[model samples]
Target: MKSFAEIRRIAIARKGEHELAARMPGPPERPLRDLSDDRVLAEFSRRIFQTGLSWKVVDGKWPGFEAAFHRFDIARNAMMSDDDLDAHLRDTGIVRHGAKILSVRDNAIFLGDLARAHGSAARFLADWPATDAMGLYDLLGRCGARLGGMTGPYALRVLGYDGPLLSKSVVAALNMAGALDGAATSKAARVRAQEAFNTWHEESGVPYAVISRTLALAVPD
Candidate 1:
């Protein structure tokens, strides 16, 4: 694999120094102490809902979603009846996809379970080792509904966690480095990608989020 310095250099060359600085994922703006499970659930819900649809559409209706889902209160959402979720299907204010709407309820249960086990879902996530982000990703897939693929990691990033986001650009950079082939969705490919990132993190001491973004920057737009 190419060194992160090489990747950063290429990124800075391609995007220019100023733009590159602007593009870096950076550290979380707010303190993690202030974040709550409800916010984490909300962000995860947003990321899952955005899949296979225009993000602009999801962002536009997020306020409606917050209202409809009772601001993502974990216990309240888990307690929502089938009839309550069904109402969202007929509600024009939100995306009417049945499975996606129902996923919210399922996710609430998932978070509630995590909360019961780990004091809170946010605490579980916070305690998860950043170096083993893939482990957390795997756990999310096994435990949470619709959290597989990129949803879990993307959700972590959205919730201000400094974790890697394995976007196509990052995948392309990995492919170029011979760490992955084809899509990085398969188990073997994912394992290889995780190993590569882990090695890079150990070598450079750069946070996974920055390493991921730097790798993505190395690839052409």
Candidate 2:
């Protein structure tokens, strides 16, 4: 694998120092532990609905979603009645996809279950070690509805969860770096990939997100 220094140098040459600094993300303004559960669920729902659709349309209708879903209060959504769901299916305020709408209630319950098991959903997400991002991703896939693929990671990222998302560029860079033999399609491959990111984190003193973006920037699209 190329040293992270080498990768950083390539990214710097590609984008230049000033532009890269401006474009690269930093630590979120609020720590993950301080975030409200409602906000976490809200972002999750937003990403869930945004999948395979125009993000612009989703953002424009987010207020309507907020109103329809009671601002994504976990307890409230966990208790959303069948009638409430039926009403939302017909409501023009938000996307009318039945499955995605159902996921809102289901994931709310998932969060409530987390709260019961670990004090609160926020605490559970905030406390998961960032180095084991793959584990966290698996946990969400098992426990939360509609959180498979990048949905869970993307939502967690919005709430300050620092981890690398396996975007196409990132996966390509990982392959080029010899992190794994190919796409991280198997459990062992993903775990190996996570270890690679962990090693870079220790070596560079940069968060996984930073390393991830650096890798993406270093490689050709």
Off by over 4 Å in 2: none
lDDT of 1 by residue, 93-178 (tens): 89998888877888899988888988888877877877778888999999888999889888888676766778989999998777
lDDT string, candidate 2, 1-221, tens digits: 77788888988988887876787778888988888888889989999999999999999999999999999999999998989989999999999999999899999999888889988788889889988999999999988999989899988888899988888888888888878788886899899989999989989998888898988887886
Q: How accurate is candidate 1 locally (lDDT)?
A: 0.84
Poorest stretch of ten by lDDT in candidate 2:
17-26
Score each candidate by Cα lDDT: 0.84, 0.89
**Which parts of model 1 are misplaced by more than 4 Å?**
none
Q: Candidate 2's C-alpha lDDT?
A: 0.89
TM-score for each candidate, following the candidate numbering = 0.92, 0.97
